[model samples]
Target chain A: MPEITYREAIRHALAEELERDENVVVIGEEVAEYDGAYKVTEGLWKRFGDKRIVDTPISEAAFIGMGVGASMLGLRPVMELMFWSFATVAWDQIINNAGFVRYMSGGLINCPIVIRGPANGGTGVGATHSHTPENMLANIPGLKVVCPATAYDAKGLLKTAIRDNDPVMFLESTLLYGNLGEVPTEEYLIPLGVADVKREGTDITLIAHGGAVLTALKAAELLAAEHDISAEVVDLRSIRPLDEETILKSVRKTHRAVLIEENKPFCGVGAQISSMLMQKAFDDLDAPVLRISAIDAPAIYSPHLEAKQLPRPTDVIAKVLSIC
Target chain B: MPLLMDTAVTTPNFDTAPINQSLTSEDKLRFLRDMMRIRRFEQGALQQYSQGKIGGFLHVYIGQESVAVGTVSLMGANDHVITAYRDHGHALAVGMNMNECMAELLGKATGCSKGKGGSMHFFAPDKNYWGGHGIVGGQTPLGLGLAYGIKYKGLTGAALCFMGDGATNQGAWYESLNLASLWDLPVVYIIENNQYSMGTSLDRSSAFRSCLAERAAGFAIDWDTCNGEDIYEVRAKTQIAIDRAHKQSRPTVLEIDTYRYYGHSVADAKHKVYRSEEEIERYKQNHDPIRLWKARLISEGVLAEGKYDEMDAAAKAEADESIKFAEASPWPSEASISEDVYFEVDRQTIAGRTGKHFFND
Candidate 1:
């Protein structure tokens, strides 16, 4: 095993897939020559040349729509939005064209396209730039939404996303890009819609994904060291085809659950998880399921305000303590 | 200070460009026959819509046949075609089977889009016809991307993107045109300026009422316009655009001044209030593309008077036969409810074992 950064893992997945499939090309603003805005696609241009790694103009609607069209033809296009919030400018192409093309064409067309970029808010990019919109994308019927918390999951899941024959929304984290985690030297793939139990316990399940997964893990460690309470950390890698069985199985054993996310509290991923648990594992719960999410406000630019806006480890710990 | 509206409207010079001299008698007949077929088929669709046989939006291409017939006829085998919702005429012009198109309108399995896409959305990938996009300017970028793919694959072909007069006002349209020019992608964006955008006329919707083609000058792209009532003028103008796209990988902005005889869609009543009966009757009688082309064919001795009448009858009969085929086709089965939501082969194995929320087995 080798410790690698999440950004490196994503680059590895993109480079390897681009090498494996001639049809797979990367298209985005600042993806090539500039080596990506966040440098997630660093050095790909030198290795793959200009055609495979395309640098597009600042036209989200045009490039995203082009991705849908190119995917419809034959090529597999990996479109990158500099930030997830920019997707609002291209909503028609994402939802109407990419999401409905296959269904509308009666399976005759498949958008083998991946719209990937950082979607989490932590670096003080403000309301417009900072958005954890996995919940919004997952709500679409024909799309697959994936948010990987670790370097290993990023490499494995992005590879699977490129190979999959449907539109995939690959949500990355601004905070997690620099974080390091252990990754195996051998090739591996983590299937979409499968939940990963990062740490096991019996007292309560602190469920999270993406940036909040790290928060839950830190909370679990604190809960064990300080309070001597065992907390299970469940990382929901993929949110759309949610692994309900894994979630319910963990809740059944723990008898208590606390869902955490960086998204706003209203109609967030936590809302869906709570409703599902209330319906499926009502009798198994020892207490009502609690949610630890960002405060119901736009992501402010002030560092202190941003800290308060997003879910912190202390918030997750408090939720777990309240539920347990 | 001079006002912008005071500028004289310089009518485009496509009518003066010499007609394609290589056209044979059969090509001339085809130009006439194709326009006639679309006009008759749309008339049939309008009658069906009135009788409650067709559902969803039925956008008839009654008056703007020359635009589709002219542009699509010049496309090569490898060239791609895409258009907005007023697409029945575009599909037929590209040689899509009439029965499947009719079946699609009737919501039957035998439809070109397998009954999934109604009147606003139709796709035939094998025929190089990308779709019949519903959203006004939704197809612009997609069409540009198709051209991008053609260049990416090293194909010596271009893509023709058809859109309504209203679609030019959308942000996507501007974004697509800018990129097409910046990248030198082989694409021709045709604005089928059919007078009205739903019920709002071009003058009301656009700031530049005199010429939509001049908007291309902002992007440094080549611009052209044609009188879409005459097939020869449309053919000559579109041929220049297509040649530039295919040979030089240059983008062109072509705005054809066409009109829709019927309302925007079959169910629309605003045309009655927004426009006058006299104006509609005038377009039908004087500037009808089919009638003008038929009269030209007879006068030029390419077709006789009796033979022209026979061709008109045959076009109507052909349209009627398609309706019969659509009436006989079966509705899609319930088992296929969620079949195409995702490509089943690439789906994760775990997805198959679970009870999905929005999709079926």
Candidate 2:
């Protein structure tokens, strides 16, 4: 076992997969010569050479559609987006071509491509550059969306995503890229649609995905230390093939749950979870399934205001306190 | 035969360009038959659409037959073909049977896409036919990717990507051109400049100098234009681009000037609003690819009088049989609604067995 940053974990996954499969190629802007926009793909390009680790012009739709076409021909492309916000320009390629090609082609072909990038809102990058589109990606029937919150999960999930025989939307948080955690030297895979119970408690349940999992954990810790309450923290690693089994299990024990995410309050990931819990575990819940998201507005440029716009531990704790 | 008769001796000064000098008389006759087959199949599809048997966008490639027939005639073992929505021409030219293509348009389970992809997305990877993409310029990048994969695998072939004149205006087209030229990908962008994009004429829609393919100059890509009515000229001009792709791993732009008899799609009824009766009559009398090829073959003694009538009759009979097959084919099962979304789930792999994949009531 070794402790590495979340960015390194992603890079490790890329290296391992690229070594294991000759068909795997990492393509994106600044991925090869510039190391990577976020440095997650650093050094792999030098090792794999230009063919395996390719760079592209800033035409998102063109290159991304090319990746879809390449994937159909059996080359597994791991396309990196500098920011998840930039993905909107290529939504037709991502959602229409990659997402629907399998179903539309009647399974005659498979688009085995992974589109990975940081999706977040806390960094004051403004509205256009800080979109958290996990819900948008997950809402589509054909795509699988992943948002890993730690180095261990990032390494495991990315490896699985590369191997999955469908289009997978691997959403990362730029804010969490350097966060460090222990990852095993041996290869392991965290299957998509499986939730991880980070902390066990009895009083209430706090559910979140991606970087919001850290906030949920922080809130859980504070609940125990200050409010004399124990809260369960559940991390929904994958959004689409949702692990309702784990979520309901945690909620059944705690009898209360609060969904939190950095995505906006309007029809976000939390909205889906809330609907799922209400439909399936309505009897077990002590109160209505509550959700706290980043304030329902454009990402403000002011750093202080942007920080306030993101979901925080205090907000999660306050939501839990009101219900419990 | 076209409903409007050739009452005027308005045929242009169409000359003979050798039809792939390597091709024998049998091969030249086969080209005529293939083009006639496309004409009949499109007629069947149009008839079906009028009867309300097919739904959503039926873009019949009636007049522009020689471009697909000629360019696809150049495909080698590793070469591929992909086109936009007006794709029945390319699909037939690539050797896909009338049965599966008709069944697909009919939305039946026995179709090529099993009724999942209607008219716009037919695929036959086994035959090296990548797809029948629907978007204007969407398939250009996909063509580049197909070429990229061929180059990556060290295979020798070109990907012939066909698009309409309208696709030339897309920003993605320029982006794809830039990438293909910068990377030296083996792709030939064949523009079927059918004189109009939907109802708007090419000159009105495209603001390019001389021709649409001329825009390739910005990317330092080689380009040329050919009169698409002559199959000989079509094959000869197309071969240059395909060779550039296969030998040099470089991209080229080829604009084939052709015409379409119908509107943009069967759904588009305003095709008559923009172009006049005489203009349409002129194309039908003078520039129709099938008519020109038929005339060229007749003069060359490759086709005798009444022989093309026999071939056209045979193609119509085959199209009729395909329509019967489509009408008799079963609709997809309700349980199949969730199938084919994931290859792993269909195969039931260990990884795919981990979670609930498809959801239904």
Top of the candidates by lDDT: 2
Q: What does candidate 2's lDDT look like per residue over B1-361, in tens digits? A: 1211133234334333343767888998999999999999989999999999998989889999999999999889999998888888899999999999999999999999999999998888888887888788888888888888888889988989999999999888889999999999999999998878888887678787677888999999999877788788788888888889988999999988888989889888888889888888888988788887888878888899788889989999999999999999999898788889877778988766766565431
Write model 2 residue lDDT over A38-156, tens digit each, in one string: 99999987899999999999999889989988888899999999999999988878887888888877888889999999999888689999999998888788898999999999999
- Please report, as a residue range, the 10-residue window in candidate 1 chain B with the lowest summed lDDT: B1-10
Model 1 lDDT per residue over B66-179, tens place = 899988878887689999999999889888878998899988888887888989888888779888999999999999989988988988888999999899999998999999
Model 1 deviation from native, Cα RMSD in Å: 3.0
Q: Which stretches of candidate 2 lie over 4 Å from their true place?
A: B1-19, B359-361
Deviation of model 1 at A62, angstroms: 0.9
For the record, the alpha-carbon RMSD of candidate 2 to the native fold, in angstroms, is 3.0
**Which pairs of residues collide in candidate 2?**
none
Pairs of colliding residues, candidate 1: none
